[model samples]
Target chain A: MIEVENIEDQNGLRPDGRRALELRQIRVKMGVFGQADGSAYIEQGNTKILVTVYGPHQPRGSTGRSTSNITKGIVNCQYSMAVFSLSSGERKRKPRGDRKSQERSLQLKHAMEAIIHLEIYPRSQIDIYVEALQVDGSEYCASVNAATLALIDAGIPIKNYAIGCTVTLINNPSLEDEDNALGKGVLDANYVEECTPGVTLSVVALPNNDSTSKDGLIVVAQGAGQRLHLSQFESLKARVLYGCQDIRTILDYAVREYLTEQSLPSLFHVALN
Target chain B: MEEYPPIIVRLAINRIDLNLIKNENVQPRIYTPGEEISSQPDFLRGHGTYVDDENTLRASVAGVLEKVNKLISIRPLKARYQGEIGDVIVGRITEVQQKRWKVDTNSKLDSVLLLSSVNLPGGELRRRSAEDEQTMRRYLQEGDLICAEVQSTFVDGSLSLHTRVLKYGKLSQGIMLKVSPALIKRKKTHFHNLESGASLILGNNGYIWIGANKQDSDRSEGGFTQDLSRIPQINREVCARLRNCILILAQCNIQLTDTSVTYAYEESMKYKINELLEPEIMIDVSLLTHQRLIQQ
Candidate 1:
């Protein structure tokens, strides 16, 4: 096992050559599947996720959970990883129906329920299914980002962009002379950095466009690995929030480009004037 | 020995460019979810806009902004069909209840086809007896397709469909294709008998049907009788060609109307029927059809 001290080099560069605040490269594609109502594929570094959204339609009775609510709609999510998704060169035994996948599915459902406007849909239900083709690190965050794009592709009404980002707090022994706030936290963590002895905080946030609030609303936050001091929590959250904002900008641009390419040419005659 | 077939492998970056055919001068205003459409309180909120905590109107879906007088709505590029009264639809019977049949019309909610709304086989004014309610499956069983019109809507947005007309009833021996509802343009007539000897029904719900043209004698038989006799090969070819043509038009995001479909079918004649499935051929055919439509 590698020590936490070697995660970052002496010149202030992470193992992947990214700075402390820099994120990995993100690529998004909307409406990748024709049969699904909405679908999106997102690649964040080496982690690849595909999310498909179906419904705003009548609820089904097959799941046996009693989804027949009369007042508002429900969001159902299923998270699964492929058998060959493990980055350590070994195949997973099961694709889904495991304890870890079920927990991630529930967390994804809660994050989706916060952004979706359920009242308008009434007795209908929306189903989102996430499939992880490759898992390096931060799989839940990639799934959340892909699910947001899929919901937008499906044209389901929602409050705002639900951006997910992971932050890691690495205790640096060599940077004692520098300021504590500058080099203590990293924006996104990969498999190597995640294995180190540090706290990895995964956050799903709704980045609002309102002028009053600078910090966006955090919908779901989960901390894993080592515990952190109470004083370091605020700065860790702030770093994750900043990372979420940057992701939102990239996703927003992709959506606009998709719309421009898919919009009918004839409708533009009536819209431009 | 038989020759092997050719396979095309292209990179994602080399996919056909859709913007090459679009008009450069027309750039529409696009909106995403939670983007503010209007800060004022006076604008009437439509289907895709909601009031925030600050009382300002924000778009709920991502699409182009549509403004009509004081009403503001964001129309998504593609979504499930929202039924309107008097619109034609093609649906499949999913279940048979006591007095109503549930029809899946590609809408948010399953539409209902009440027994009272359909015309009985005996006559137009015949009463619906208790035996008629029990034999509802005999008229339209599960998994059967039908053509109907939207009669009204319930408080929960489910549509009530009617098949009282002589033209709307159980459809038999046809090819059905589903496309995005946004690609279908609303026109005066949804049914068209093309010059190529094929009949087409462009359902507002995005379910398109292509079949042999029905004779005048078939209409007087209450539409329950089926013509099981084999259709001629020429008619089958025309139907297959028509189906491929409509798929091409939909893939290119061109509106599906009778005129545009006919133009596509005509332009696709240069290539054989199976050859139309090629990526380059599909793009070429749709481009020709688009150019012809602009000239009109």
Candidate 2:
């Protein structure tokens, strides 16, 4: 077993050599597939995800047609982990169609629902398919980030970026004894740290236009591992919010870069004219 | 003996240099979702814009903005095909219903192709009969590709397609490649038979078809008869080459039209059909094609 003490060395560097607050390098590409209405590929740290957005078209089949809302658009999400995503030596029989996959799919829909402007595409259904090619840690967070880019690629109207981030509470409570309440909480926790006995909080938030908006509207929050104290929740949530903000800024830059590439020669034409 | 060489792979970066674009005085304005557009009183909200609580017009998608009189709209970089009357499209039949066939045109909804709109197999003015209704699948069965024009659009944004013209009917023995709908240039006609032996149909919905040049197609039968006869090796080679050329051009985000495609095909003649898929060759051919377009 990889112990938390072993993962976090005496120098305060995690096994990945990233500081507690530091994020993994992010790389994103939009419109990775021509067939999908909108598609994106994103890599954060060692985790990689590909997301494709289809529809806002008429719902498919009788079930899709029957379940679609008349006044608001339906956001359907499927989160599937690839067979090789497991870091364990043993392989799983099924990549999806399991209880855990279903739960993750539902959680993804909730995160998407909070961001998408559902009322604008009334009677239509938008399907978001996320495939996790590799899972290091924060797979859920990476899925949210990749889906946001895919929605942007598809030109679907979104209210704001639904950025997700995970924070793990360090076992070293003595750092909290020094007066810095959040000293022991690590931002953007990885797979090994996530597996540690400490509490982990995964939050999906929409950062407000106001940069100082500390606790932006939380869309989804899932806590796992050891039981967290009520007093620790505030500090852990704040750390996650900060992580979310950093991610949103990176994703926003990516979206702008993609848009610039898309409108290129038109800019040239305008300049020449 | 080996007929074709194995494929080679190389890594290349596809980054757009914004600094180079910045040298130009006119940098195209781009909008992302939730970005404020305007608060002016006279401007009306358009398809890609909505008024927020403070009466500020905000963009809903990322793209360039267009203004005409009081209407302000942001056109997304890419979206499902939004149909307009008289627009040409190529689609595959998904389902054959009672009086219509559901055609997937890469649109927001499956477009409808009514039996009444298409020319009957025997003649143009044939009356509807029980036999024709029962044999609807035979006329244009599921998975059959067809070229048609947009007759109308429903309020929900679905399209009604018609194949009344001789050129608009079943397509056979062709390769179809889909690209972003925004890349297709709106032209007077979508069908073209290049000086090269391949005939091309650049669907407005971005479904392009390239096929062997079929002269003297049976028009009296209304394109229902299949020409399953084996095309010569040379014609097949020409069709494959044209397909590769079109794919490369589309990949580079070039506007697809008859002139542009012809230029790309001509520029790509120096390389084998498979060689054109290489990153360096694709860029070289498209760059030459781009230069020729500008010169024209």
Compute the interface RMSD for each candidate structure: 1.6, 3.4
Best by DockQ: 1
**Cα lDDT listed for each candidate:** 0.84, 0.80
Cα distance off (Å), candidate 1, residue B89: 0.7
Model 1, span B132-235: residue lDDT tens: 99988888999988899999999988899998887888888779899988777677888888899878889999999886765334566566666677989888
lDDT for each residue of candidate 1 in A71-158, tens digit (9 for 90 to 100)? 6888899999999998887999999989989989999998889889888777788999999999988889999999999999998888
Q: In model 2, where do residues sit more than 4 Å from their true spots?
A: A4-20, A56-72, A87-90, A120-124, A171-178, A181-184, A211-216, A219-225, A229-232, A264-273, B11-26, B40-42, B122-126, B214-218
**CA shift of B179, model 2, Å:** 1.9
Error of 1 at B248 (Å): 0.4
lDDT of 2 at B57: 88
Q: What is the C-alpha lDDT profile of model 2 across B1-296, one tens digit per residue?
A: 86877866544455332122122345566777777788777799887788866688888788778877888887777788888999999999999999899999988778999999999877668898888889999989999999999999887678999989888889888788887777776788788888987888889998988878654456778776667788899999999998888888777777788898899999999999899877778888888888898888
